[model samples]
Target: MLSWVQKRGTSEHRTGLETPLQGPKQRCWFVWDPMGIIFAIATWALVLSGAWVLVRDLLIPSNNVFYAIANGVVFHLLASLALVSHLRTMLTDPGSVPLGNPPGPDTVSYCPFCLCAIPERVYHCTVCRRCIRKNDHHCPWVNNCVGEDNQKYFLLFTLYVGLMSTHVLLLLAIPVLRSHARGEWNASSTVSLPGPIFFLFLVALMGFIFALVMLCSQMCSIYKDKTTTEMLHQNKHSQGRQSMWANIKAICGPRVSLAWLSPFHSPDRYKVSERHVMA
Candidate 1:
């Protein structure tokens, strides 16, 4: 969930309009916002297109052991995981604070604009038009808020997508570079890769760089047990009392040992609550 240039106070472009208060209602929080939707569409279109081309080219890689792993396992599993996590992050609601009256004294504050209870670590998202649980950032790529509910999916998506892109680039890089330098692909080669393959490789490399940066930033936030929002607004932020491992488990789930490393294996994953955290 990378929001590099997010205007923190800007109201949602379209959904910012406060719907007429019904007998008890004040505003709409479930309506769609077009700014994020458009960015998500364009970003995912490029991602899917590049992934397709990479997978197509790597279907039957060289008989060498390294290439075999790259083609058979890494390409299929990582790409699939990347796709799933991406979709999950995009579709999953990053958890909105319950509307209306405050549930309990635990709520740290109240949002005047939305007239909703604001809990600890949660903040109002102007774009989402709601207070998000453990609010992190609004990611235009996923067109969703990255908060307590979907942070894990967002992280996994970033890591897997970055790895997959790098893998594709590595696999095709030699051929692309050699061909470019020599001015022609080797005619005698058993597999004749398209010229566009080089361009695709370059594209994947760029994606890798972008994802890597996001991954590192997310990891740093996790290590500090802070959300991007909290980090950005340090003066106004207060964090939960959780250790580093507790922070990781909160996001990666109980099956992090297995699920973090593989997409095909979902070995009884479950979310940890605030009670599970250590001081």
Candidate 2:
């Protein structure tokens, strides 16, 4: 672990590098957590199912099933793209670099990994294998450090994923209701085992439900202008309160929407208020 520390009576500071941190076991990569694997599989399943529905509709000419499938696919694609883009931005944003120096007094240089001057509230992530800007803890799900640049995207990803999940749930529920209303299944009808299609729908339903709940909770925390890490840290420190609403407004300013459409934005375009720093 690496850390930045400041001298008590002087402006001079230093960065400290500890023992090397290794990544998760190789098996972890291959057998990703069951939840993650399920989520990934469900995501791909939805995409393939959507495609099948579309192709089937084209071939049959009158099947509405394809239309429903197309809707689900589009919703998933947009949400997934938005979420991924946001995650990418968070992982690569340099600004997230925290504000001091490495551990040794004579070390004139900063850690290339973190890219921050280094001070309090900063730390290195073993997962990212780099010093983080304004270092927050590493998120295993994201497989990256959430620093200054990517914070906004991370928030956006959570928000959009929740919305997307809710949308998918609704979309799937609608067709299911219709099918039941038509009395397509009766006691006399043989109960076929749930196939890939049924399982895909089930997975999507469950994934979105879970994602939506988590996203909503995170959004509430973000709306208050705090990270999960920050919130937890606050419990142990005497830091002042942050105005989350104000931070949100600042990030979502006039040009904020542009973030969704494009990945490369001038840092200058995103104005950081003193209030944002306080948070």
Q: Write down the lDDT of every candidate, Cα atoms only.
A: 0.66, 0.47
What TM-score does candidate 1 get on C-alpha atoms?
Answer: 0.71
Per-candidate clashes come to 0, 19
List ranges where model 2 is wrong by over 4 Å: 1-5, 12-62, 65-73, 76-80, 83-87, 94-117, 133-137, 182-194, 233-242, 250-279
Residue 189 Cα positional deviation in candidate 2, in Å, after optimal superposition: 7.8
Model 1 RMSD in Å is 10.2
Question: On residues 55-113, what C-alpha lDDT tens digit does candidate 2 reach at each position?
Answer: 34332353566765676466757656655654454345423333223333322235556
lDDT of 1 by residue, 49-146 (tens): 77666655555445466666557576777777887887778776676665653323344456766675444676888888877777788888788888
lDDT, candidate 1, equals: 0.66
Best by TM-score: 1
Number of the top lDDT candidate: 1
